[model samples]
Target: MTEYATGLVYPNGIAADEVNKVLFVADFTGLHILDLVTGKQSWLSDGGGTYLNGIDGLYYYKGTLIGIQDSGNQGDRVVRFYCLLFNVDR
Candidate 1:
């Protein structure tokens, strides 16, 4: 198994950037991007700076990554129903 960052306590989604040779993982706390060749991992956004908590799925389309976050909380259902978009090349 690959060793992820300490902060990646709950990884729920995964996607790949073939052209960039990187893997994107959606963790419950944030987004982690890993370099396939170097084995280096970095956070795209730590949950504190962004509203990307509870990411559940990932999809790559036309060079963009779509992240689905579902917290399963009844109170904040409106925010949980949205998907986040990130440019793969950035």
Candidate 2:
């Protein structure tokens, strides 16, 4: 498969957090959060696993991110992580 963000991970799996306004990219390098509003990138996990080959899929449930990690050794696996949204009243 073709992969972008060469230095990072995943290169495939991607997710969207509507409420938080962030897009989660599971690109093998790690879990990345792209700010939907500003189009900024942030890392969640530097290296989720040894082989962060790809991100099969991603979804949001109860304000958390549930996704799949595709690797070389293990075909595919499901993983869960938390996403926090900070609210500031100006």
Q: Tens digits of per-residue lDDT for model 1 on 1-90? A: 866445676888888874656778877666777866677787775445457667778866666677666655332322221224433344
TM-score (C-alpha, index-matched) for candidate 1: 0.65
Poorest stretch of ten by lDDT in candidate 2: 81-90
Residues 18-78 of candidate 2: C-alpha lDDT, one tens digit per residue? 5656666776545666665665566665344544346677787766777777656377778
TM-score of each: 0.65, 0.61
* List of clashing residue pairs for candidate 1: none
What is the overall TM-score of model 2 with all chains considered together?
Answer: 0.61
Instruction: Report each candidate's C-alpha RMSD, comma-separated, in the order given.
Output: 5.0, 5.6
For model 2, how many clashes?
Answer: 10
- Candidate with maximal lDDT: 1
lDDT (Cα atoms) of all candidates against the true structure: 0.63, 0.59
Off by over 4 Å in 1: 1-7, 46-49, 72-90
